[model samples]
Target: MPYVSMSALLAFVLVYGLGLGPIPFFIASEMFEVAPRPAGMAWGSLANWGGNFLVGMGFPTMRNVIGPYSFLLFSAFTMGLFLFTKFYFPETRGKTPTQVAQLCSRGLRSRPLTTATAKHIL
Candidate 1:
C-alpha cells in the first residue's frame, strides 16, 4: 500500500477545522426550537463526542488493517453527507424557527427526493 504523506493529513485537518468543525454546532443550534434547543444541543454534543471517541478508539485497528485505504471509508461517508445536505437540507437564512421547521416538513412531504428545493446550504 502507498503511504499517505503528512501534507494530506494536514489538508484534511485544515478543511475540517475551517468549516466542518464549527458549522455543525451553529447548525444544530439554529435547527431547534427555543424550548428544546438545550436538549438538542446536548444530544448533538454527545453524538459528536461519541463519534470522536469511536474514531479515536477504532482508528488504530482500522489503519493497521487497511493501511491508507482507511481514509477512503471516511471520504465516502463525507461525500454521501455532502450530497444529502446539498439536496435535502433547507435554506434557513432569515427564517424563524417555526418557518424553518414548516419548510422542512413541507419539503419532506411534497417534494420528490431527487429534487432539491433549497437553493444551497453550503
Candidate 2:
C-alpha cells in the first residue's frame, strides 16, 4: 500500500509537471486575439483554479459515495479531456493568436497548422 501510494504520487507529479500543469494558462493566452486576450486569460485562470477547487473539495465526498469507483470516474474525465485536447483545442504552436482564433472559429475539424501558414503566437 505504501509503494502504491508512492507510485501514484510520482505519477501525478510526472504527469502534471510534464503536461497538465501550466497548460490552461498557456492555452488561455494563446487562444484569443490580442484585443480580447487579457480578458480571456483572466477568465481562463479563474475557471482553471475553480475547477481545481471543485475537484479537490468534492473528491472526498465523491469517494465516500462511489468508493473505489471514484478512480474510474476520474479516468473517464481524464480521457474526455485528452480527447478534447486532441480533437478540438486549436494548435497554438507556431501560429498567431488571431490564426488560432480563426481556426477555432472554423470548429472542431480545422486544418493542421503548418510552418508555411504559421506565425509567432506570442
Instruction: Report the number of the highest-TM-score candidate.
Output: 1
lDDT string for model 2 (6-43, tens) is 99989987987787777777877887788988898888
- Number of clashes recorded per candidate: 0, 0
Candidate 2, clashing residue pairs? Answer: none
Stretches off by above 4 angstroms in model 2 are 1-18, 107-122
Off by over 4 Å in 1: 1-15, 104-122
Q: Give one digit per residue, the lDDT tens place, for model 1 in 11-103.
A: 878987797666667767777778878887888788777877898899999999999899898889879977777556787899999887677
